[model samples]
Target chain A: QQQVKQSPQSLIVQKGGIPIINCAYENTAFDYFPWYQQFPGKGPALLIAIRPDVSEKKEGRFTISFNKSAKQFSLHIMDSQPGDSATYFCAARSGTGNQFYFGTGTSLTVIP
Target chain B: NAGVTQTPKFRILKIGQSMTLQCTQDMNHNYMYWYRQDPGMGLKLIYYSVGAGITDKGEVPNGYNVSRSTTEDFPLRLELAAPSQTSVYFCASSYGNSYEQYFGPGTRLTVT
Candidate 1:
């Protein structure tokens, strides 16, 4: 069973457009949600994160919108650029455990 | 600080072959994890360690083994290679159970 599920295996957007990637989880125990970005042949890097206590968190052009009750979270990239083209993964960590569950990932392509 | 480092960016193995994937972190993190990413399937946790000498299995642990003898090093071993194990492997480390994780450049392994 996949603990975390993500939609849209791939996405394409033009420069300056907004790209949204969504994820859902069934475990209510998950309290921390994070998004990672990976380029070809490189490791995934932390892009942004959010705590379920807050409805949303934003850093620069990246923002995370979290709904605790809905058990869902989404990442939105504002003014998306060609450089933002990469694979994005959403992960959740339980408050009571050390293991993290990751989503299948969404490959976003920004066209110039 | 080099964050995290993984050895042998790529490898190829024949059926029944064995190999060890090395992971090291200079951040002195106590939590470490190993994950495998397959095409369009996302990333799955294979094994994780909370601290030295304390290891646990994650979502996918079959055919894979891990050991953490020190705060900075975690190694994953494959006793026998199989086609199903052909995927990109990643190592990650964090300060605590729910803290931000740092990931290493993945190791791409192929089995014939």
Candidate 2:
């Protein structure tokens, strides 16, 4: 039960719209959850993360809403622009392990 | 500082050929990891290192090897390249057990 399943393999949103991507994990032992953003040919970068204790976190136009009871977390981009188009990955890790389990990833397209 | 750096951003190998993918971190992170990303598969951990002289295999470690002689360097070796080994390799580093990780640009290898 070490999998993190992400939904909507791909998504398309108009400019200035709000785009949301969801992820659910099967392992409740996972205490740390993080989201990463990757461009076409670049490495994934740490976008924002939330701990089990926090229900939500906001950084700029990016926000992460986490639910411990539901074993789910989501990333929301407010006023998404064309530049925001990229692949997003959700990951989880247990408190005792150095390994991070990643989701299949979602390809997002923000059209102008 | 170059958080995490990988060499030979791209490579092509013939069957049975061997090569080493070099990784280094200037942040002096205690944790270093190697991951492979395939289309729609997200990132799969191949190996990880907690500190100098310490290394361990991850989910997919077959046909691969790793060495951690220094805290700043963690290299992955492919003794015999195969078609299945063709994927984008990424190196990441973290200061502690925290979920936040810094990733390199990634090295794309194609085995034919």
Candidate 3:
């Protein structure tokens, strides 16, 4: 079973537009959610992360909105630029274990 | 701090070949993980180590073995490589309390 499912396998948006990617998980024990951005030929880097205790978090142009009751979460990029084009992955991990489950990944493109 | 680093930026091996991917972290993080990324697919966990002597298999660990003999080094070994093992491998490290994971540049491996 896929523990975390992400939507919109790919997306394209004009500069300054908001693009959103979403994910959902089935495991209730998951307490931490994180988003990663990866450029071609490069490894993924952490963009932002949120704990289930918070409803939302923002860092620069990246924001993560989480819904614990719905077992869902979404990532929003505000005022996106071409530099924001990359693959995005949403991941969840249980607080008790060191293992993390990752989504398939969303390829995002921002055109100027 | 060099955060995390991986060796052999790229490699190509024939079927039944064996190789080892090396990973090291300058940061004294308590948790380390190895992942493989394929095109259109997200990152798949291969193995993880919580400490120098504690290691466990993740979602996809077949044909792969790992050893964490020191806090700074974690190496992944492929016993008998196959075409199905062709993918980019990444190493990540994080603190026990911190949810953020730092990733290495990645090693692209192709098994022919």
Candidate 4:
């Protein structure tokens, strides 16, 4: 079962614009949602994360908007830059489980 | 702090060959995971370990084995290389499995 689903397999945005990537999960037990950024030939790294308790969380130029009732969440990149061009993955983990579910991924390209 | 490190950044193997991908973390995390990523696909977990000597399978665990002999070392073994196994492998560690998962660079494997 695809526990987590992500939209927009690829995206393109202009520099200084905001680009958003969304994801949804089916498992209700999941409480932790995290976003990862990956560059070519590199492993994905944690970008930002949020729990089900909060509606939104922002760090620097990145923000995560989450809705517990809808089982959906999104990652927004503010003032997108060329350096932000890469693949982004959304993942969810249950509070008590050792497993984590990951979304397919979204490739973002920021135009200079 | 050399959060996580993987050896043999890239490798090419022939069918039926066997090799082990080594992963080590300096963070002394208790949770470790091995995941594989295919083109345009989200990462699939192969194996995971909660602590030394405790291992479990993940979503796609076929033809792969793992051992957590120590908190710092988690090695993934491939008994017989196959074309289907050609993908990028990543190692990740988490302190207590909450939100953050630190990842190693990655190992690119090609089987012919």
Number of the predicted model whose lDDT against the real structure is largest: 2
Per-residue lDDT of candidate 1, residues B1-112 (tens digit) = 8889999899999999999999999998899999999988888989999999999999899999998889999999998899999999999999877558899999999999
lDDT of 1 at B40: 80
Interface RMSD for candidate 2 relative to the native interface:
0.7
lDDT of 2 at A72: 92
Give the clashing residue pairs of candidate 2, or none.
none
The stretch of ten residues in a row with the least summed lDDT in candidate 4 chain A is A93-102
Q: Please, what are the lDDT tens digits per residue for candidate 4 over residues A1-112?
A: 7789998899999999999999998888897899999998778999998988999999999999999899899999999999999999999986675888889999999999
Q: Of the candidates shown, which would achieve the greatest DockQ relative to the real structure? A: 2
**What TM-score number comes out for model 3?**
0.97
Per residue, candidate 2 scores C-alpha lDDT tens digits across B58-94 of: 8899999999999999999999899999999999999
| lDDT at position B64, candidate 2 | 99
Model 2 regions lying over 4 Å from their true place: none
Name the DockQ score for candidate 4.
Answer: 0.74
DockQ, per model, reads 0.77, 0.85, 0.75, 0.74
Candidate 1 has which clashing residue pairs, if any?
Answer: none
| Tens digit per residue, CA lDDT, model 2, A1-112 | 3399997799999999999999998788888899999999999999999998899999999999998999999999999999999999999986676889999999999999
RMSD of each: 1.0, 1.1, 1.1, 1.1
Tens-digit lDDT track for model 3 on B5-24?
A: 99999999999999999999
